[model samples]
Target: MTTLAVPAARFHPLRDSATMLRRNLRRMVRYPSMTLMLVAMPVVFLLLFVYVFGGTLGAGIGGSAAGRAEYANYVAPAIILMTVTATVQGTAISIAMDLTEGIIARFRTMHIARVSVLTGHVVGSVLQAVFSLAIVIGFAVLVGFRPTAGLGGWLAASGFLVVVTFALVWLAVALGQVSKTVETASNLPMPLMMLPFLGSGFVPTDSMPTVLRWFAEYQPFTPIIETLRGLLTDRPLGNEPWIALGWCAVIALGGYLWSRKLFAREDDR
Candidate 1:
């Protein structure tokens, strides 16, 4: 009997990552509504804020009028980013869901590359992230929010955000694996997604209460907000971009290690 050992290098730079993503893309095209609903969830939240709570909340932000443009001006990016945060956990849930139902056993019995399964989810979420950003941006444009920074700036902001999303997907994967139920996966992203609310997101941290201000000014969200705002308004680059990247990297590695730990415990590493 001969056994072929797979090198660990197989996963780095994600050689199988695109292949996994392409497969999901085909699935997404086949199940358009499923993807649309996923894309729509954040838009639903946007609508809630825009119509139901926007008028009053606008004053809380910069004054009145939280349209898809002005209000979304501050929020649309975060809202789009939230889609990644929200869906990345789905990968972990996918793993755990399959595990709980013995579907994982079925996959393993077929000798699929364990990495491929996880990669598939990450890649799919990336596509979802792009679609989410496009939908939010399209709504923002329709509402009169023009990117004063021009196409290059818009693309730059989008690219940075995609990096942020890339980092977050891994965190979600970890959480989904760590969680016990699918419901937990669905609920866990809410808090982390809301972290930006307390930071320099909707309003400047300077306007916040003294003690509360300190925390909001320093958390990961602060940097992310500053980076996005600077890019959109053509303001000076703040330290937020670096800080945001650092935060993302830390969270991603931690979650990746955590997911690996969980994976190993189930007789696969």
Candidate 2:
């Protein structure tokens, strides 16, 4: 008697990831209160800075209506950056919640691709970040933030935002994996949220003291913020875009590798 050969089922990580992503996206739609809160926080920051502190900050930048306009223009980029950082907090918490709630264990036992689970979170978070950025920028425009850049500039600015969002989301993923609880995950990325303030996001680097000025000039967020400002306002980019791209590369790679290692460790546990 002749034996027949059997064909094994093919595994498609991308297809699996897309399916998982749809599940997460559906969850986001079903529970939008968190998204609303995340979106609102950036708008509040925009209002607080432009109205509450705009007078003093505007005068510092210049001295007339032009000064106010200048301040609005300068701060818009920072607030957009803040929007991205703020939205990623939910990503971390959601991932941590899943892990702690045994969702990952359930996924592991299923006959699906493993990496797809994390990929779903990353994609969902990045999309959320972009939505938050758009809302914050719209609020900024209403408050007198104007960009002098044309189509090319807008495109470049968008590209930079996408890059930074991806980098930050990856980092958030790693943070989520390391945290033992959702609360801890929510707080772990606080420093990432605060980095803009410590950098030249609100003021000129020269305005800061020596040590802070140095740090403000060199920190990862500064270059990214400056690149964004330059793209939006027709200012000289200098080397900021390159530096910001380098930082994005480093963050994305490090976060991806670390998250994968931690995720793999789940099996060992």
Q: Evaluate all candidate structures by whole-model CA lDDT and list the values in order.
A: 0.70, 0.90
User: How close is every model to the real structure, measured as TM-score?
Assistant: 0.81, 0.97
Model 2 lowest lDDT segment of ten:
61-70
Cα misplacement distance, residue 108 of candidate 2 (Å) = 0.5
lDDT tens readout by residue for model 2, 171-267: 9999999999999999999998899999989888899899999988899999999999999999999999999999999999999999999999997
Q: Per-residue lDDT of 12-69 in model 1, one digit per residue for the tens?
A: 3365556666776786678677556666766777676666665566666765544335
Clashing residue pairs in candidate 1 are: none
What lDDT does model 2 reach? 0.90
Model 1: how far is 109 from its true place, Å? 2.7
lDDT of 1 at 241: 80
Which stretch of 10 consecutive residues in model 1 shows the poorest summed lDDT? Answer: 8-17
